[model samples]
Target chain A: MSTTATAIDNKKGLWRGGVSPFKASYGKLMMWFFLLSDAFTFSTLLVTYAFIRWSAPAYKGEASDFVFSTEYWPIPEKVYEAFPGFHGVELPLVFVGLMTFILIMSSVTMVLAVEAGHRMDRKSVVKWMLWTIIGGIAFLGCQAWEWTHFINGTEAGTIGDVVKNGLWINNYEIHGANLTFNQYGPPAFAALFFFITGFHGFHVFSGVVINVIIFFNSATGMYERRGHYEMIEKVGLYWHFVDLVWVFVFTFFYLI
Target chain B: MEQVSNVVVQPADRKKIWGIWKVALILFIVTSIEYVFAFTMSKGMLLNVIFVTLTIVKATYIVSEFMHLGHEIKSLMYSIILPMLFIVWLIVSLVNIEGAAIKGARGTQDFTGSNGATEQVDEGH
Candidate 1:
């Protein structure tokens, strides 16, 4: 048989074997579809955020009208304004900036790892993957800190002064606690914030773990033996998806 | 694997990965803009509009550059972006409806409470 005939025969045999029908590789295609679905999920959450904010009565107070007080949707700056120490200075949204920076940096490292994979540079691939993992961990740390600050409620002693009302207003008392429902905007807002951001944070944590494993595998030449590092690209897709969702969260939840 | 055609199969052109420093620079610039806006702009409808616009721009850069989605096929891009837009529309409509209901409820509650008390006082007198 000629070379062309032999190639055609092999193609026919493989087709008859009844393998997966996807035109692209299974991993890459799946990542694309997964990202598409995830995009929808995030959009729903953001939309829900908007709906709640709109439906909830808006208090006429400015963002800085209250400090460390749960009064009026908790002001993104007031809820997230911590930075290691420097307590009582009231720096709003500074920690969120740190979190955003960390995630973006991790994304940069992830892209570098994907590039190194394309170049088949095992050493660089491992190194960049490790860096990416570190960045992910750092982001998770920032998230944990933000969560702690939020759940602990800033200035616990003042809780008695707030009254329960639908409106989130400053100086309101809820159930004799200084933190009124009005001051905090609504309970649903805090609940959704925790759920959505916590879910994203969990994804980041998992991504870091997966990156660590890939880093080790690359370090030991496992993918070199397999002759491909497509895994890196797939993980990069997930990492990017996480970052993309954060953009929406920051825009709708924080900035808006 | 059909008969491997004799046509020239050019190697896929790999795009250059943006440098970390450049990515860092972009992040810094975006964050600085966010900070400046947060501090300089008072909270209101104008601030809300500007903040959301800037956020979308920053997000686009991150998605296109960091995620490398810019190199993807047109179909793939639409598959992602279109569904997201729909979700946004749905959420906005729902929120607006709820806002109207709450406003109505608050108005009714105030009217009934005051009217009921007045009727009872007139009967007592």
Candidate 2:
């Protein structure tokens, strides 16, 4: 009849419904589950992307010998060469690489914030969170520019005969990607690009918004008054999950 | 109602902080290697295998080090990762089956034509 701590400890109340078997708080556990579901969502999208690309005829010949043709799937390096401010330079994969670096750095800052929060260092949390926000916005900016280029496309008017880096200059006059057509090989190419990257971008956008809220909360000493910074750690999980998704996206969407 | 915060605030752990930077460095190095392969290595199955493997490595570091799941109990880690392993298996097999089916049915035909020519219809708008 002893309902004491020693009794519960000795009894191993793991399945007795008084302990967390996973050793994680309820909020953190739920966040992990949510990320698992999100991982499924992203995996399906990328899998679909791979399926569609695989079904199509792959570009044959050397990578450098690649060309834009409606007859075959476009090589990724050929399509993603346009860099900001250095237009017309065939700097393949550079911009997206920079974007990846930005997201990775932001994730690092978020972890630092969580580390500072463990010590209830409000000042460091604010500083690191602010940097994380900046990195997210910068990433979004890069995405916006990339989307514009994809949508607007290279000067639309040249005849289809003029092939630049494999893309026909005048394919139906309206170049780039849109709701109905894709100048980059197959329609699914642009469609999947927009859908997958756009979905990931939305996640990044929401992550930034949440970071801002956490930043405000930490800045105002909310956690200080409450005596713990568990909230930062939870959000840090979400922020890092976003980064994890990007690592896969960078590989599947761009690198492959 | 005031909810009691039972969590204890610990002092800064410099070793843990340094460990984080080390993981970050590892991630950066892996990404740089991918970039180098992307440009220097030609596109093929070998390059793809390298990229996918590196990506998984980066993902592991993020989930383990940054998300701190690596420090969690074994049950929790397995609960998350085991399901993911199944999901990945499903995706790989399904994508292969579906992709092969489509390719077999189409046989390199120019199906991209006309469907991608919708711009001609919408040009006036």
Candidate 3:
């Protein structure tokens, strides 16, 4: 009877309140919840983008029909062709691919940093954190270049087509994209581009900031003083979340 | 996790390094395949299916592996992931209804107009 009671007590303790899934702490669980909420927001935006893209007409009017002729949508390949130096050549999807690769590499470094943190190795954590920050900076630089190119746009429309008011009249004058006008096909395309990428870029910017802070803390041996490097792992969760979002964004915007 | 007097910090999980590398490798390979499809496949049902499937695969892998959710208690994992099915349902139904509305509008709306076309609203005017 004593042994049975002890066994019941142990089981109660183990299953108390509820099984803590994976023994995850409150912070990690909350992080998952936060990520889940953010997922919904992102998915809505992307799904709407698809809905708009699918419903909208590809080419608005005919080239021969001068009065009605205006192309509203630019093909993804055509818009994203030129690389930074090779502006003259049409190299589609290459630059975005590079950006994606950089982000992925950063994620790898972050994982390594976390791995090092698990071992309580401060030097390895700092090194990996520094590399991860550099990768983040590089990705942001590439995005800046991309945004500039997108805003400036390329020459669009036919020869006779001219800018009437802000709208492309006979011709679609390729200009920097904004709320009102841009040269890259439809205004919605540019608008959606700005909204989606802008949001993601903001996340990256904040991630970098958090990374820098943690990097400084790790350098100063803050986690070491606490006898644990859980901070690194926490920030790591955030970093990986950022990378995961990027994966989705890359697919929605660039690839498909 | 609650702390106790005897609670000792465990050594770093060394084996996770290998797992991370494998997941990263898989993600990279899948992305490469996506690029291949982008250049080769014309836009169609098959292309869409491939993109969605690969994207889901990549996402699930990232969530499970990188986030370490897969190692978590089964109930916790289920609690988190099961709700996402509703999100998928929401997206599908909304897109379907909205798409049907817009595609139907194509019949009534004359897109070949010379006026400055804004969004759908400006198009009509």
Q: For each candidate, what TM-score against the reference?
A: 0.77, 0.87, 0.83
Chain A (alone) TM-scores for all candidate structures:
0.80, 0.89, 0.84
Best by lDDT: 2
Rank by lDDT (best first): 2, 3, 1
**Model 3 clashing residue pairs (backbone):** A22-B73, A72-A186, A151-A176, A161-A170, A161-A171, A162-A170, A162-A171
User: Evaluated with TM-score, which candidate comes out highest?
Assistant: 2
Instruction: Give the C-alpha miss distance for residue A36 in model 3, angstroms.
Output: 0.8
lDDT of 2 at A28: 92
What's the lDDT of the predicted structure labeled candidate 2? Answer: 0.82
**Regions of model 2 farther than 4 Å from truth:** A1-12, A156-171, B1-11, B109-125
Instruction: State residue B46's C-alpha deviation in candidate 3, in Å.
Output: 1.1
Lowest-sum lDDT 10-residue window in model 3 chain B:
B1-10
Restricted to chain B, the TM-score per model reads 0.61, 0.75, 0.72
lDDT per residue as tens, model 3, A1-256: 5666666655654546334545787778887788779888888888888787666665445423422122355557666877998967879889999998899889899988878877777778899999999999999999999998887766552232434676656434445677655665455787889999988898899999999999999888778777777877777878888888888888777766
User: What's model 2's TM-score?
Assistant: 0.87
- DockQ of model 2 vs. true complex: 0.40
lDDT of 1 by residue, B1-125 (tens): 23332323233234455354576577679768878988888777788777777777777787777766676766667776787677766766676676557646543211122223321111111
Error in Å for residue B13 of model 3? 7.5
